[model samples]
Target: DLHNRFKRGARSYTGTCKDEETQMVYKKGQSWLRPALRSNRVEFCRCDNGYPRCHSTPVQSLTNDCFTGNGTLYRGIQSRTESGNSCLKWNSPRLILKTYTAWKKNAHDLGLGSHNFCRNPDNDRKPWCYVLKDNLETWEYCDVPKCSTCGLRQYKESQFRIKGGFFADITSHPWQAAITTLDRRSPGKTHFLCGGILIDSCWVLSAAHCFQERYKVHEIRVVLGSTYREKKEEDEQVFEVEKYIIHEKFVSETFDNDIALLHLKPKADSLQCAQETKSVRTVCLPDAGLQLADWTECELSGYGKHEENSPFYSERLKEGHVRLYPSSRCTSRHLFNKTVTENMLCAGDTRSGGKEGNLHDACQGDSGGPLVCMKDNRMHLIGIISWGIGCGEKDVPGVYTKVINYLKWIEDKRRL
Candidate 1:
C-alpha cells in the first residue's frame, strides 16, 4: 500500500532543448526518458525557461539517486557545501574567542560563575576565588566547587578558647557576670585568677596587664560558665591557650591600649550541654556613629574580691548597676584627666545620690569585661573594663575602652 501510494504521489520534471545547428525541438525527458527515470526515481532536468528542476518522481527516487547520482539531493548538497567551507563562519569564531578571552582576563567580573569554578575543596584550606558582595562591601572567600590547591585564608578576629572556667546561666539577664580576683599565692599550687568573659570559642579578650611575663599563655587555664568559686573546682570547663596577643600599643605603665587576646590551643566544643553548658557568648561592638550620651544607665558584674584583705571567697558572682557619667565629669577626676583619652569611656556617678554612691567600682581582673548600657530594653556593649586609680574610690570612675573606637578594626578582622 505504501509503495503504491508513493508511486501515485510521484512528481514529473519536464524540460526542453534544441539541436544547436538544426534548431530542431528536443525534450530532455520527453517519453522514453520519463518512464526510465520514473522507474529509477530520478527527477533532475532543465526546464523550458533554462532553469534546473529536481523533484521526487517515485518511492525509489532517493535510493536510485544514492546509487546512480541522477538527481540533485538537498541533504548531500548541504553536507558538501558545509564540508568545503571547513565548518567555519566569517565573524562568529572571532566573536567567541574574544568573549572567552575577556572572561579569562577578569574572572572576578563573572561573579558567581567564577566562584563556582575556583572554590577550595579541603576543609582546612582557603578558597581560591575572592567575591565582593554589595551588602558586605568587602572581598570574601568564595564557597563553591572544591579545589585542593588553594591558599590558606587568615582572619584578624579569630576564635579562641579560655580554659579552667565553669559555665553560668546568664540567659535570664543577658548580662554576663564579671568576676574579680585578688593576687594571692597558694603554696605548691597555681593561684586562681579573676573570672573572664568568653568572647568566642577560641579567643578571650582581657586586660593586658592582668597577666605578666610569668603568666605564660599555655600555663593559664580558662574556666567557662561557673558562678561559685568552689563550684569551679568540680563543675567547670577549661581550655588551654596556644598563644596570647597583647595589643601592639598596650602601655603597661599607663594601661593605654589595655586589651589582650588569648588564642586557645584546642578548639572548644560549640555544642551546648547540661553539665558542661556552652552559654558563653560575645557582645557585638557598638556603632561608631552612635553617640555615647544617648546611653544613660549601665550595669557591671563580677566575682572580684569584695575587700582587699577579705579571706572569704565569694561563692557566687556579684553584679552592680552603674550609670554612665558625663564626659565633663569624667575629665575632672585626678590622674584620669591625663589617662582617660577620648577612646576611653568612664562609667559611674560622681554626683550626689548616684547609683554607684559610695559603692566600690571595678577592680583588677574586671578589666576587659563589658560596661553594658541598656537601650530599648536591650543590652549593648558600650565599654570594655580598662582601669581606674583604685577599685571603687571616692570621686573616681571606672574607665573602659570605648567599643566604638574598635568597630572598624573588629569588622575587618571578622570578615570571612
Candidate 2:
C-alpha cells in the first residue's frame, strides 16, 4: 500500500523535509528513509542545505564501491544484473516465490525503494537482484567494482623516437585500439576504419567523423592488444560496440569537436570488456589544468597509411613523434584556412628537412587515436587524431581534438 502511494507521485514542496527514520530534518547528504502511509508516503526530495537531491548521490559515489560494511547501506541506482539483464523489481509479481519471500521479509533494509535498485539483502559480496528469463527466475550479482581495481593500469614509459613514424609494438603503446566495421557483403570480414585509444576497460575514444556514415553498433568492433593492422593476435581482445557518443556540436564541414566515444559491450559471462594484459592497458586521462610546454614532443600510434598517398593501411602499428606548436603558429591561416576552433590543437615534426626529407605526422586513417605526452613517468592523453594535411609534410602541422576541454563532458557522458 505504501509502495502504491509512492507510485501515485505524491509531492510536498513547502514543508521542512525530515528524515523518516530519525524524525529530524535531514542532514546534508543523508538519505531519507521511508515513513508509513500516515505521512502520505511522500519521499523527501531534498534538504535545504543543497547537497544533491535526496538519495540522488548513491552512497557508493561518496566512498568506494561499497559504502560501508557489506554495502547494506548502498543506495546506488543500478537496475541491471552483472550480465546486462534488467533486474526485476522487488515487488514485481514476476519475482520467483522464494526470492520474493526473502525480499518481503527484509524489504526495508534491502534498500528496495519504490524502484528496482540493486541492493544487498543478505550481505552477499555486493548488491544483487533477480531477473526473469525463459519463463524462470534467477538471481545474479551486480557490477560493483572493488576500490582497488577501479581505473588500475600499468603505465609504461615511452622511449620517444620516430622517423616518418617507425613501426611500433603493441607492448609499447598498449592503449592503442582499432575501430573496425564488419563488411555487409563479406559477412565475417572486418575493415579497419579508424584508430582508437582505450580510456577504460569498457570505453574507447575515437574520432567522430569516422562514424559519419552511421554504421550500426552491431556492425562495429573494437580491437585491442594487437600489433598487426589486420591480423588477430592470440592475445588480442575483441569487443562489439554497445553504443557510441559523438559530440552534439560536432561539425562535419569544419571538423570541429571531432571526438567520439565507443562503449564496449561486455562478454556474456563478465561485466568487463577489455582485460589488462602485457599489451592491453588504459591510458590515463590528463588533469584539466595540465599544460605541456610548447615544442614538447609527444607520441601517437595507429595502423594508418605510412604515407599520404599509400593505398594500403600499415600492416603493423606505427608510432610518430611530434612537437606541440605555439598558439601563434597554430591558426587557421597556418592550416589552409581551415576552421581551428578552441577545441583543436596543432602538433607536427618541426624538423626542417630538405626536399627528400620525411616528416613525422599522423596520416589519413589514424583519426580517433591517442596523442599522449609523458608526465610523472606515465602517458597522459592530451589529444585525439582529428584532421591533417598531406602526411609528413614539412611546415604543415596536423590538427587534433584537444581533450582537456572535454574532461568534464567525458565524465558526465560516461556516467549516463
Candidate 3:
C-alpha cells in the first residue's frame, strides 16, 4: 500500500486513496500522496493536558510556504515547524470556491446535490449554521445548515415518539450504549452498571459514578448499534474500553461534575469503533456557546425500569420525554435534602397527579443515559440522567447533569 511505501522512505505515494468508510476518493498529480479532491489535510492535532501540541496558523504565519495559482495558500492554511513541513490548520478551510459555479462543479464530483446550498463554506459568516465535525472542524461545504449529519437519520427526534418501559424499535436510538463489566462481575459473566452515549467514533460519555468501582480498561465492555438488552443482534457492535476518564473534580457527596468519558478499543487492528450505519451513529454535542432554553421538552432513553420498585430493569430498551425545569424550581430545597448545584438541573412530568396523566422518567438502571433534544433538525445531547428523588414522582422531578455546562470540559478531553 502507499502508506507502507511511505513508511519505507518513499518521498510520496501518488494516484488515489479512497476513504473506505465514506467511499470518498482522494487523487493526486504527483509522485507523493496529495490531498484528496474534496479532502482536507488529515493530521492528528495532538494535544496534552488540554493544550494543542502544535499551534496552527494561516499559512501567512508559515515560512517559505507560498500561495497557489488561485492566490490561496498552496495547501490552504498551514503552519511551519522545525520539521520543514507545513500541514493545513484544523480551523482552515479545505478549499475556497469564490463563485457558485466553482462550488457546483466540485459538488458534482462528490455526487452531492449542487442545489443543496451555497458552495462557499462557513467563514466570516456567523449567523448561518454550518456542518460541524466531531474533530472540532467544519466541513468544506456550507451546504449543511447544522450538525444534522453528525448522527442524523430519516427519523426526526420527535419521530416514533417513544423508551422508558416498552420494547424499543431495533434502531430507535443509535447513540445509546450499555456500559457493563467486562466479565469481571463473574468468571464468565458481566453485568450492566450504567448507560452511555456515543459522542464520537472513539469516545463515549457516561456518569463518573459508574466507574467508581475502578474498572480496568479490559474490564469494561461497551455495546452499541443494537436495542436488545441481552440479545446479540447481528448488527450489534461490541468494543472493549481502552481507557476511561473521570472528571477530576467529581464529588461523590453531591454528584457534582459526575461526567466521565470512555475511549473505545476498535474491533480489529484496522477497525474503527462506532462505525456509521442506519442503526449506529454518534450524537451531536451542543455547540460550546449554545444555550438551550429552559422548559424545553427533551427525550431520554435507557433500559432502566418501568417503575421505581421494579424487581429488575427492563428487558428491552425504552425512551421517555421530560421537559427542562428552570433552575429556580430545580434547587436542593425542592428535593429530599440534597445539594442541587448549578451543574445539575431537574426534569419530569410537570402534570399533576398519577398514572394516566403522568409522563415517564428515567429510573434506577438508567443512570448515565442521554437526555437529547432536537435543535435545528438535529439531535443534541443536552443532559445526562444523574439522579432523582424517586421514579416519576408528582412533585419531585429527576435531576440531571446539565450537558451544556460541561461542553467545554468534554471538548477539551476528546478534541485531539
Candidate 4:
C-alpha cells in the first residue's frame, strides 16, 4: 500500500494526525448537531445550523433505574421475571448467544459492549456474542478512521534545487526537524541542539548521543516547517517534548546503534501534537528489506555549520546531495579509528574534489538529522547523521546510524 501511495504522486497526503478531533468545528453547508440527552436516550441534538444549538431540553429521569425502554436496550436490571428478556445488573444476559456469529450491528452501535467487541477472535472471549442474540442483523463501525499513516511526503514547491552549503527551503525537505534545548532558569529562549526526523505524527527519530546531557523532556523542543533558524513563519509549528527513549545498546565510545525516539505531547483537547500542512510533514520509514545500490543518489539537510572550523551554525536550513559509499570504503579504517559496524552506513560527495571542489556533507548541528533517499519517489529514511571526520573533507565520508538495521527495534519501542 505504501508503494502504491508513492506512485500516485502523493496527492492523498494531508499532514494531519489520524486521530479524531474533539472540538465541534462547523463544516460549511452542514447542520450543527450538538450532543444531548433526551427521551431516556443519549443521542445528537439537532441544531438548525443557521442558529446556535438549543439546550433547554432536560434529561429524562429513570424510574427505579430499571425501566426497559422501547427498542432493544439490553441494560442490566435489579430484578426480573422468567420471560427470558430481563436480568439483574450482576447476572448474565437473559438470552446468552454462544458465538461471534451471533453479534448484531445495532446492539454494538448502542454500545452494548463498548462498541469495540467486534475485534475479538471467534472464541469465548468475544464480548458481543451474547448481546447479539437480540438482533442478528447488521454490522457497522461508527466513525473509525478508514486509514492511518497520513502527513507523509510533503515538500515546498520549487522550480530548481542542491548538494552542499546553500540556503534551503524546509518545504523542500519537510521531514527535517530542528531539535532544540532550553534552560529552566531562563525563560522565553532556546538553543538549537540537534537535528531530527518526523517518522510518526507524535514521534521524532534522532541520535541517542544528542541527548547526552540528559536534558529533561520539558527542556527540549522540536521545531518543524521553518526555513529560517530563528524566524517563526506562519506555517511553522512548535512542540514541547513529552519524553524520549534512547536505545539501550548505544555505545558512547563507538556510537553503535545510535538512535532514539521523541514522543510529542498532545494538545489541550488531547488531539495530535502537530497538524499536517505543506510546510510540515513526515518521512516514510524504510522497510527492513529495502536495499539500495551503494552509489545511490540521496540527500541530507540541516542548519549545521558549513565547515568543521566554522564558529557559528547556519542561520537558515541547508541541504546537500550525497551518494552511498561501498562497504569497503565505509569501513572503520577509513573513518579515523571509529568502529563502523553493520548498524552504520557511510555517504559522501564523491563527485567533487580539489582546493575548491564544492563539497557537500553533513556536519556539526546536523547530528541526529535524516539521510533520506528517493525510494519509489517517496522520501524513505536511510540513516542518521552520527559523526564524521570533518565537514565536507576530501575522501572522507560522514558516518550515519544505519536506520534499516533498527527497523525491529523501532517497531518494538513504538508499540510500548
Candidate 4 error regions (>4 Å): 1-163, 353-357
lDDT string for model 2 (1-416, tens) is: 44453343233334434333322343444454333344333333445443324322333234433443346767655567778988777767666365543247545545653456677877775788787878788888876544322223444445434447788888888899999999999989999999999988899999999999999999999999998988779989999999999998899999898889899999998877898787888888988899899999998889888787779888888888889998888899998888888999999988776232378889988989989988877788999999987888889899999999999888988998
Q: What is the lDDT of residue 183 in candidate 2?
A: 95
Show the colliding residue pairs in model 4: 15-276, 156-171, 163-320, 163-321
CA lDDT, candidate 4, residue 64: 21
> Candidate 2: deviation at residue 133, Å?
28
Give each model's whole-structure lDDT: 0.45, 0.76, 0.64, 0.66
- Backbone N/Cα/C clashes per model: 33, 0, 6, 4
Per-residue C-alpha lDDT of model 4 across residues 277-343, encoded as one tens digit per residue = 6777788888889999989988898988877787988888898888999899988789887788998
* Candidate 3 C-alpha error for residue 132, in Å: 31
Where does model 1 exceed 4 Å of error?
Answer: 1-189, 233-235, 267-279, 308-313, 332-338, 350-360, 410-416
Please tell me which model should have the higher lDDT, number 1 or number 3. Answer: 3
Most lDDT-accurate candidate? 2
The deviation in Å at residue 75 for candidate 4 is 36
TM-score of 2: 0.64
Tens-digit lDDT string for candidate 3 (1-416):
33532232212124444322222233443111122223343221221322222222332333432231222112222223223333222222432432222244453242222111222222222111123345442334222122235546546333343323345653667888988885643685888889999998889999988888787788788888767678789888888898889999999889999899998988776556777676777888888787778888888888887777778877678888778888788987899779988889888876554463235788888899898888887789888989987787777788888888888888888864
Model 3 gets an lDDT of 0.64
Judging by lDDT, tell me the better candidate of 2 and 3.
2
